[model samples]
Target: MSEKIFSYLEVHAVDHCNNNCRWCNNHSPFCPEREYAAGEYIPWMEKLEKKGIEYDMISVMGGEPFLHKNLTGFVLELRRRFPRKSLAISTNGFWLGEEQIESYQMLWKLTDILFISLYPNLLRGLKDGGDVTPLLHKITKHNPHLKIDLRQKQTFRMIAYSEEPVEPNTFCGTSECTTLLADGRLARCGLGGYAGYSPNVGEAFRSSKHMFFDLNRKFSKGEFWNWRRRWPFDACYHCDSYKWRETNWKAEKGKRRRLDLELEHDRLAGGRLMALGNFTQAESLFRRTAEKYPLDAALCNDLAVCVSHREPLEALAYLAKALEIDPDHDDARANLRRLRHVLGRGTENARPEVCSADAGVR
Candidate 1:
């Protein structure tokens, strides 16, 4: 890669992971089973070299790097080509076994750092029945020189696509990700990279070869590295972020979690408008979101807040529905008490509280 391109770049050994994590930004679980040949990256790297791009590190990661058919050979070639480049390999030991010890040793000897993600499922005797946990400890025992970065992933960043109106210029925290996916496409980040692969994301932004940056273009370092135009095909409206629902870390197994993702995206969008005192737009958004995701109590609570001003009775019905769905809904409960007090005082026009997403935008 060119010095002008970036300091970091990631090359996946494969895109299809054994664990289908829902919060995965890369959308690994959604992708088909395929191993990336080291040869595919040669021209991409050479293009960067031609453009004078140099990077500080080249991270080798995967669905699981060990799943790659040509594991040792792949990194061996990368090490040969860029001997000075720092190589880091990220893996979950699900695919690793006693049989692959020699290959693991060779890999440990070759790479600078080994990142092991100790997901709860892996620790709780999942899949391989606690075989992987012990082998992870052995990495340092044998390869004393290799660095081990262990990550205890209890929480993950949520990546969701909105079915709502597009916002055009949304710059995400993930835009800084500079990884090349298994399809030989170098993307600004994994979220944009898995355009055609991710369940909801594919539907939101249809993937095309053109969306993937043209490596053949005679673009300068700044032109090559410009993230805005390249990511999400000009407008980043289809994607947005908000409060993540805290759920247990388990595999979605490539299941579509679109409804909840869209719920949060649309609800949060309405919440933002509610914060700006744009109750009209917020009301419209919340009602539309409710039609899409009717059973969610949070949406009901949020919807109640917006409609409270013009339709106190409708707001009461919405809040009642939220409470009926989830009796422990604190915001709905709190809004109900406040709404009742206003009615008892005969000041029904008084805006109660925009509780829930906006935390009662008064």
Candidate 2:
């Protein structure tokens, strides 16, 4: 049987983040945009509830979910509406002090999980110190019954870039990976906004009156998993220990301003080589270019695909490397799935039989 594709909901309460970590991919501190107001949330919640769409899991994230003044109220409302549904939140955990903890007490009663971003630099007092470990431990200790995942920065992953892409890494490719922006836009994965594309979540939801309409339109019919375009990396992608390249979209000034230019050059060169079906040479060029700019997920993804036929094991290695850098890498994940199946069927030793004239590594 095919895998069941479960649907989940993510609501971005606010886009204005408080932390100013150097590796922040969305450039949170630099993001001068704010998405929603407290009043806006209730209506959306009501709409979802009226539709009888009980989300498998409702994920609350933002520049920081706790940044919202009504965070506690929001959690309570959600719990009140969907008593049996799972609730989760991702936060920098900076405001998680005594008062905040007390406020969260009500939330903890309903929340099933809490994902705290343990960015070393985001700790308190140590330049970018905003340690959440103590807070996380405290929450867990107090609740004792709550489940928590202390997500380190290294666990994130990225897809490969087409030009100088970065190495892959390990990640859990959740079947229900999806995100909902404050504007009600839906994306295939959590990193969609960071990756530079709008999956039109809000428009889909408003038009159809059902969240599944957007989900089915984007996944089943839209083939949302395919990565054919290019986008820069965000803080989550950069903080990922497995990441290789970094795109400073905010830096549009001097010598460093032309970073995208360098990436573009490599992309063009890499594309030409790939067009000739020269996987070996293309892989070599991509490897060298990626070394200088390791954050390009698209490039890394391409190199992995090129070498898959010639060297399945090597290709698997490259795909794994690409995934390490970008966990949301749909292509790398798909390719890795295929490679694993090929290797498992004991076809690793089998060679394709081709006519001599047509067999020239076509």
> How accurate locally, in lDDT, is each candidate?
0.65, 0.51
RMSD of 1: 22.0
Error in Å for residue 345 of model 2: 90
Give candidate 1's whole-model lDDT: 0.65
TM-score of each: 0.60, 0.45
CA error at residue 123 for candidate 1, angstroms? 2.1
Model 1 regions more than 4 Å off: 1-5, 96-99, 126-134, 165-171, 181-184, 202-204, 207-211, 228-235, 241-246, 253-362
Give the alpha carbon lDDT tens digit for every residue of 97-146 in model 2. Answer: 43235435556766788887754433332222454556667677656777
User: Candidate 1, residues 1-362: lDDT per residue as tens digits?
Assistant: 43444666788888776666776766777877777877778668766766777787888876667666556689998888888889888886543333234334556678788887866755563336554556655666667777877776766666567655465454465655577754446776666676667666735445333345656556667766564235445324555643344566767753642345335546655665676677777777666556646457788889778888787777777776777678789898888778777668335334343335343322
lDDT of 1 at 184: 49
